[model samples]
Target: MDKKQFVDEVRSIAEGYFERGEFFCSEAVVKTINDVLDKPFDENVTKLASGFPVGIGKSGCVCGAISGGVMALGMVYGREHGQAMQEKMFPMSADLHDHIKGIYKSTCCRVMTRNFEFASPERKAHCIKITGEVAAYIAEKLYDEKVINK
Candidate 1:
């Protein structure tokens, strides 16, 4: 899909706000990116996120956005060569981390809330939408940068 098309698809998914429970925005991003790349949804990424939003237990250890980004990165370039692979992945992982961090710095509940339990219903909805947007933006950027292909 093209950039506008991808953004529109994400916007549609995020339009409906949710007050509680895990949002499927992360899954949506994975699905969209996979679609764009003509790749299947990586089972590992999906599994990693199965308990998210809820698994956070309202603590927000790693923001869902970053967590989801890590999942996608793992799927694209997971370790197989042990230590060497781990070392090689540092820069790549850092790139993904920085991308998410930039977005969070601008508008974030994960930073402000400290504890997810403190998030108001409005904050939850905002975070839900933001997570979706970040996922889409990163996925599209990777595709455009030729880091992945359709």
Candidate 2:
């Protein structure tokens, strides 16, 4: 599919996954990235992201959406043998981090969700939208950098 189409699809799928309880924010983000990208990763990648929710075991540090976006970028651009690839990968991940943080003054999950409870309706809707946004942004960045074909 085209980049636009892919981004849209990722957004929808990520949101659906979260809203349907198929996955949490972090899991949904990684799952959407895996689905949008042509290459399939080990199923455990999503599991690795499991603890990232609520800001790493709910400690509420960096946003899980940002973490998941970075993971998605790494899956696409990370090198198995060297750090050289990080020059490119890190910037992309940082860009995503910046974008997400710009939405709120802080990237801390606690700060971002301070207005709502974890299981509250508002928090649920907010998390689902952001999870989807991060997933879609990761896909768009990959396309913009020509890491993937349109």
Best by TM-score: 2
Which whole-number lDDT from 0 to 100 does residue 40 have in model 1? Answer: 51
Residue 43 displacement (Å), model 2: 1.8
Q: How many backbone clashes does candidate 2 have?
A: 0
Writing each residue's lDDT as its tens digit, candidate 2 over 1-150 gives: 877897898789999998999988888988878766764797778998998988987898888888888888888778887556657787887788888888877788999899998789999898888898898888788778776676
lDDT of each: 0.54, 0.84
Cα lDDT over the full model 1: 0.54
RMSD of each: 4.4, 1.6
Error of 2 at 106 (Å): 1.7
Counting clashing residue pairs in each candidate, in order, gives 0, 0
Q: TM-scores of the models, in the given order?
A: 0.63, 0.91
Runs of candidate 1 with Cα error greater than 4 angstroms are: 7-45, 81-88, 106-110, 114-120, 147-150
